[model samples]
Target: MKPASTMRPVRTAEAATTSLFHRLFPVNRDIAIKSIFGVWGAYFVFVTSRFLYVAQGNVDALFVQRILMTSICITSTWLLYRLLIAVRGRGMKSAIFMLTLPTVVLANYIAILDQIVFDHEAVVFDFSYLLKAVDFASFDWAYVLDEAFTRYFIFAGWGALYLALSHSQDAQRMMAHSRQLERVNRESELRALRYQLNPHFVFNALNSVSSLIIDRQNQQAEKMVDDLADYMRAVLTGGAQDMITVEQEIAQQVRYLEIERMRFPERLRYSVDIDQATKDWSIPSLIIQPLIENAIKFGVSGSDQPINITISAQSEGDRMRISVANDGRVIEPTARADDRSTGTGTGLTNVQDRLRTLYGQNASLLLANSKDGMATATIILPDPSQIFQDI
Candidate 1:
């Protein structure tokens, strides 16, 4: 089981950053653009006021200040877009590099073009004029790089925040799934256990044992008692667990079936075919025995034809499939409920429930009546090794 407290740090960081970005910026692109426009508009008003104070009524310098502020706003908007992609997958370094380089070249070009080429009076700006206006002392290339780096540093911090938030949400979802699966597993085990202790079944088996004693078969009757004891012990002890190996459960079933064979020596015949590869596979305990019992009771006994029950196991991909078929009449709606009820309907019901619990609707107990008077009940369970590895 994964620890409740531990989490992947990268995933955690990404989730937090993603969530924070959504909360702060929201999804409405028009609204976001409008909000940015409003902020820049206000900044322009504040800058105009400052320029007026400094020039003391000179309108030309105020015009230049307005142009500088507008250029800064456009450059900032472009950088913000690049920062968004960086938050998605690109780390801090990529975000900063991409955002800064383009914005710096563009911003500097806009400033130089303003003073040199577009001087309002058509004053031509030559190489020397643009070079002198570069102002190495204050507006040097190093200074521009430093400013761009600082702006992107803030953007990187926001990206980290969103990343953390994304991971937390994913962890929360997995935790919920784990809890649900655990509950379903418990229900499957409980239902499997409950069906194992069918009252009518015990009563019938005991009655059969008594008949053996009445016929003066004292030795056989004692053996029946011993077999019943072992079957009950396995059912009781193994029922608590969710699953047991196919090999172990089948061994118990063989013992139980041998006891049943004693009751109908000539009437009942049984055969089992299991692939060697699937013997050690796992399945919900006691799943097959009930089907076999049903076959013997409904198909073989009291009918003119001798009952031949066949149990087979196979594997498909990561799952193990098994089928139990018996030579019996197809159960019709008009068939007496009392006759059918003699065996454990509880067992069949439990098998279906366990299948649903473990694999939701994908796993199932399938029943079909063949043309040759063969009734088959097929059970498909997830392979335990594969299931364990997946979890």
Candidate 2:
């Protein structure tokens, strides 16, 4: 009589109960097999020991019946275990209701089955008799409560064990997921730091080539192109790496300086002073290139006087201190706004950001004018051997 969209199949009480039972006790082949092995193994041992001691070597129908009843009890407990796991997180009240009701019903059902099928006694299934005692005018509830009480411990034990195992598995899964997310985030940050170096270096190098082309220095331009090709090959090869040794980094910077040398000729003179003890120390790749580019941009490009830039490194106890200094004329704070020579000026900031990302507070970059009037950029790195070990 209803529209097709509104039409719903009516579920009877018995059908609904069966659906709820199946939903709460969903079939898990592994858990089912484990329950059968574990529950039956323990039940059989207990029943066999009791029968052997009480029956005194006599095999009887009662002993067989007891074994069968124990098997039924174990089966019920395992089914209850499945229900408890399903009802977990559904609140304590729901869990206790499901547990207590099923146990009581199953115990009563077994008692009825024992009287009818195994004992063959005329046992009346009446609630009135449960309230009456052998003595007149006295009501005793013990007989009615005996079977349910006896089975409750077995079900409770199984429930406790199941809850413990479930909680353990959930904690392990949460820990694994947390670790996976941490690894993903660390990798994403490393990729971001790597990408920042490439474009900034390429932009400066290309700008130099463009300047040479404008000046019509064909011979020097051709040589610069060859040098640039070699420099790019090295950059591309090492771009994917997160860290490089001090020596490798210096070699890369030397390639960059060689290109710059072709442009400046006699106007630019630079030197690298590195301690032999710190050469194998690991540092972030291309970290120092931008500082050198900064030196070139502000030092040689802004001055008519020949500017000298120096990069020096030394070990200070557990730290490696590196400095890039240039003898360029310093613009006073008042002249900074009028100085057209201060380019986009992102190189120093880029170096600082990458240092912060890679080393947090363990590394630092500082910019200051030295005593001899040189614009000095200093970087202090943590102990490279210890840093590598930490990574």
Candidate 3:
């Protein structure tokens, strides 16, 4: 993910503006009013405490005076802040040009109005009377300057924080969209790969049948065609869904092997040891087919001794583990291995990719050579609860 520092400043400024307006309505408006009132109330109480000490107990009048001053301050600050934000993007020079004079004018107006409104003795907005009422000698221009700097710091700090927050929210939404697109792309590729397997396997099986027909083995050719038809039917059934029960997947594998069995009649054989519990589990459709095809291509198709392939599935704790082992030795570690008679390297590659897409890193396909003179491919994955519990 890109950092916020890399984000466009113009967009950030626009988002901040939007956030400010959104903070001013309905429930948000209520909150802002409450917050401003609370600040005034606290300042009013503080002023009343001072008046009680100064006048030796006449606190009500001084409390009212503080409320008027506090209200004037809050309203003036809010309005000034809005005006400044409105001109923020035109650069510091433009912002200062648009805001400084208006803000000074507003402050003077508020100062004079508070005197006339709160002090009924004052008949008009008089600068000298307002200055005297506020205690001119104790005005403290240095303190006023300090307060002005503090107000700017506080406002600008909040503005920066709100801008950062808005950027973070937008970044989260973007990341989620990107992740969704990646998932859809992966699923499309997997579906396309799954569909491609049926045809590739078909072409190979038909080619084998052609060879047998040329050799005048009409009976074996007929058996191959029947197996092909059954396999195609299974493909159609499984292709209709993204996933299928383990039992259905096994049925498809059996039909596929039957076709190959005809091609290498006495050279290939297989066994199954599926757990009753696993029969109800669901796996990605056509996932195991390509793995089985890979095993046959490398381990059974052209081995000197008649090859025996065994497929077994069982529940291991909360997960299902399936292993397919064939009686074909792995080439020596130091030797360069020859390509298998059947070209299915790409199929097995697709199998790995599909497994990763479906199960992330949790699902795995492992290949190893056992000391018992067999090459094995194992798939380990979580059992689908929907398939089991629903049934």
* Best model number under TM-score: 2
Give me the runs in candidate 2 sitting further than 4 Å from their true place. 1-74, 85-154, 157-161, 197-204, 210-219, 312-323, 327-349, 352-362, 366-391
Q: What is the C-alpha lDDT of each candidate?
A: 0.65, 0.69, 0.67
| Stretches of model 3 off by over 4 angstroms after superposition | 1-154, 196-200, 208-230, 233-237, 331-344, 382-391
lDDT of 2 by residue, 347-367 (tens): 666777667666667788877
Candidate 3 lDDT score at position 114: 51
Better-scoring candidate (lDDT), 2 or 3: 2
Candidate 1 structure quality by residue, lDDT tens digits, 1-391: 6565565776788999988777655533444445456555665677667754574443664456455546565456535654554454566566556545654554555444434433333222222443444444434455455544543443334334433444465577789899879877667665645556656558877998999999999899999999999889888865675577778877877887788788778877888899887888878778787787777767766577668888889888777789888886556424445564554265677777666655675677878887887888899877564342323
- Which one wins by lDDT: 1 or 3? 3
Clash count (model 2, backbone only): 0
Tens digit per residue, CA lDDT, model 3, 318-378: 8998888888754432342243334536666777777777776667788788899878778
* Top candidate (lDDT): 2
Q: Could you give the candidate ranking by lDDT, starting with the highest?
A: 2, 3, 1
Worst 10 residues of 2 by lDDT: 118-127
Report the error of model 2 at residue 228, Å.
Answer: 1.9
Superposed Cα deviation of residue 333, candidate 2 (Å)? 12
